[model samples]
Structure formats: structure tokens, C-alpha cells
Target: METIPSSDFFIQFWGVRGSIPTPGKDTVRYGGNTSCIEMHVGGKRLIFDGGTGLRVLGKSLLKQGPVEAHMFFTHYHWDHIQGVPFFTPAFREGNCFHIHGALPADASSMKQHFCERVLHSNSPVPLEGMHADLNFYELICGETFKLDDITIETRPLNHPNGAMGYRVTWQGHSVFYCTDTEHLPDRLDENVLHLAREAEVLIYDAMYTDEEYSNPKSPKYGWGHSTWQEGVKVAQAAGVKRLAVFHHEPNHSDDFLDNVAIQVQEACPGAFLAHEGMIVSVV
Candidate 1:
């Protein structure tokens, strides 16, 4: 098994669920962690989001010794930034991290968001205790940057309070990380298609089913989430080679997801739901 994450290009899902952590017998198969994903490309480690799942990924990284990584945030939602306090690697002295994210629409700097909200003074874990060499970078949506030979692109996502999608391409292979975004009711998102166009892998936000999203009694409209059904549509339109359905609904159990997974395959044979510990290779 390819256990180590040093592949030329690959992704590992440490936490796959959305909104909140759902731990219990019912959620075992699909896992309950929220939002963290790790990707290794061109000899650099890149992470997306810092949900509860990041704590687990941190533990694993400890065994690999001193660390250097780049972490990106899609938005400042509680579930997405809640795991920073528990990430062991961030507290270790010799490690380094370059954190990246756009300023929230409210104009709060990423640093202020982390210090004031995530690592609050009231919390037991203080920012003072984290000894890692943390570097903060301002990432603007619609901008493109390069890390050596790797090209990273960003796009604005349709979400409340705003979120950003990322497209990383290296050696002609690409992976799209599009989460916490909703689809247009009538047309495919041009920005989403631009990033996913013929990409090797696409990890998308599929936090609700169409039925639940439109449930008359419990509607999820304006929830800033998309359905697996919409994911299929985007993948097909973008000619994505494989689709990884992500950001699972918290209320969904393993069995519920199993049924959904089956349906996903029926709709798009190569598509599968993202799960804790699931790994996908892009090149």
C-alpha cells in the first residue's frame, strides 16, 4: 500500500464530513471528521481547511519529524477553522507552516480571524503556546501563483460570507478542491468548470442530497452547500476524469451514504463519496 504521502501528486482525506463532527456507530464507515484534506505535489505538502480532521492528520505528521507545509482556508466557518487548537504539529518548535487565505468579506484579516476567533484567549490553548514558524499570506481570489513548477489557481465560490476554490496543477495534471459552494440553479458555474476542465481529480462539496436540499419541511436553501447530483453535473460538463464527492452531510449515516454512493456510481461510474482516510492520486 502507498502509505506515505510523498507521491509526486496525490491527495488524502483526513476528515470528510461537513458542518460538524459526527462520531457514532452509524457514522463509522464514512467517518465523522470535518473538512481537512492533505495533498502532496511537487515535493510540497499542501493542506486545505482545518476542520477536526486536521487533529488526526497532525498526529500522523509527528512521526515524520519536523514539518514544513502550506495550509489554505476556504472560509471562516466554525467547522472549517475549529481544529487549529488541537493540531499537535503547530505547537512543535521546529516546524513551519505558511497559512494562506483571503480576507473575509467582513474585512477581518486571516491572522485576526485565527487569533481572535479560533485561538481565543478564553480557550485553554493559546496562540502563545504554538511554537511553529507560522507564516501568513494573503490569497486573492481569481489570482494565480506558482510554487516552483506547480501552478495554483483560485476562484470565488458561491457561498454565504464567501469561500474560495483552488486548482492545483503540476506536470499537466490537475486537481480541483471546490467546497462550501453552491451551484447555480440553471447553469454550471464557469469558474468551477475552468478549474475542473479535464482535471485528473475533482474533490467537490456535496453536503446534501437534492431532496434534503429542497426538503419542504427542512430546506437547506442558501446553506452554502451543493448536492452530489450537482457534482455529477459539474464533472460531466468539465470532463473531469474522476469525481470525489465530498463534504458529507452530518446527518447522513454510513448506510445512508452507502446508498448515496451507489447512486453516485450509477450516475457517474467513476465517482465515489469521499471518506476519512480515502486517498486519490492525481499523477
Candidate 2:
């Protein structure tokens, strides 16, 4: 098995559910929260997506004191961006956050989606009055950028509204985060393959089971999410050492996720399902 680095870098999952946040009796085990993950690199915090889990993430950060944080959004979808307005860190005056993601050329900007309330149109929260210094950058895919000691490489994902997968490398360790993507077992994109190459951890969207993906009642056929079987194939093909299966289906129970994890491990030895509050150290 490939081991992580010794730099003390770690990733913590705040939310792991896909599509919508599931809050009910059936979802407590694997967590019904939506997409949010925190990466601590070189003493700095980097957040991936701001789903409903951001509520908990914000409280945790607030208690830890103000810190410079960056949010790397996969896309402007509701489940991924809805937690922005509620993030406690964003409401603080001295705290700052940089929002980076892909955008449509014809649309005004990614920020507009937040302002227009495509998801939470009735929600009372507003971004204009936030005290944090915010910066928005719409990055082109396949570009590499630096954040302190980390080098981030972005690649466009195979999704409806378009999403970007990020590969962060620093101090001889690398983590590839690519959620909300869909792929076939035998076919893979060169860019995605390159991004996952030699990665210590690959956090990917394995939202559907093989049967669900191919079944008639599957809600996500054309919605752009991969099954665990497909995810395993891609991980193996990309030479990924460990695969963290993410973006669980909203209706899936913890038992279902447990079974899925076992199946994925059988296919690829290092596959595991991402659970709420699950933390992995890369160093």
C-alpha cells in the first residue's frame, strides 16, 4: 500500500451526500450532508465546495479563530454553493476567502449564481453585507496555480454545467479531488487520467451503484455521476494509490454505503467511502 507524506497535511470531510442534503433517521450513519471537504496544508486551510456541511465547518473554524481560507468550487450547483452565505468565516471582517471555479462564457459570472439565488431563492441571507474580503476568480481548465507551498492543477470534468477537478501537490505529496463527474469503465479522459496519476489520494464522485446506474429508476443516468464500479476502473487506470469514494446518494443508508465500500474494496484494494468527519493525514 502507498502511504501519505510526513508533512502533517490532512483532509477532513464535512459533508459527503450528493444531489441534496438528506437529514432524517436513515442518514445519520454515513451522513446525509452535502459536498464539503477541508484540507489543511502547511498550516493553512483550503475548503472544497460549500454545501450544507459548511454550517458545521464554519462553526469549527470560528472556534479555531480567524484564518485565511480558500474555496475551490467544482461548479455553481446548489448543493455545492448553497453553504457560502452561511459560512461563519465569510461573515467575519478580517477573515478572507478566495472563490475559484469554472464559468460559462455567456453567463454574467459564477458569482451571479450566488447573488441570483438559483437554489435558495427564498432564503434571507445576502452576500452583499458580508464583512469578509472576498475574491472571485474564474479559472480556465488545465492551468496550474500556486497557493503557498501547494501547486494546484485544474481540469474540466465531464458534467452538464461543467466542473473542475483539482490536483494539489506539495512537499512530495499529492491529492486529487474530482467530484460530480461521470465516466465509463473502459473509456477515460486523458486530462482526468493525468490529474489522478500518482496521487496519494483521489477523492471522486461515486454517487450511484452499478445496478442503480443501469436501472430504469435511477435518477442520475444523465446527471453525470459515476458508479463505484466505474470509479474503481478509473482509479486503477489513473494509477491512483487510494480512492476515497464520495458524493453518496441522498437516499442511500449507511448500511448501503457499507456494502458499497466493501464492493469497491474488492474491485480495488484501497477504495473507501467518505464519511462525515472522516479525516485522513497525508503526511
Query: What TM-score would you give candidate 1 relative to the actual structure?
Result: 0.96
Alpha-carbon RMSD, each predicted model: 1.5, 3.2
For model 1, the stretches where C-alpha displacement exceeds 4 angstroms are 105-109
Candidate 1 worst ten-residue window by lDDT: 1-10
Inter-residue clash pairs, candidate 1? none
In model 1, state the lDDT of residue 171.
93
Tens-place lDDT digits, model 1, residues 55-148: 9999999998789999999987878987888999999999999999997666568788678776777667989899999888889899999988
The global Cα lDDT (0 to 1) of model 1 is 0.90
The deviation in Å at residue 140 for candidate 1 is 0.9
After the best TM-score superposition of candidate 2, give how far the Cα of residue 200 lies from its true spot, in angstroms: 0.4
Q: How much lDDT does each candidate structure score?
A: 0.90, 0.82
What is the Å distance of residue 229 in model 1 from its true position? 0.7
Give the Cα-based TM-score of candidate 2 against the true structure: 0.91
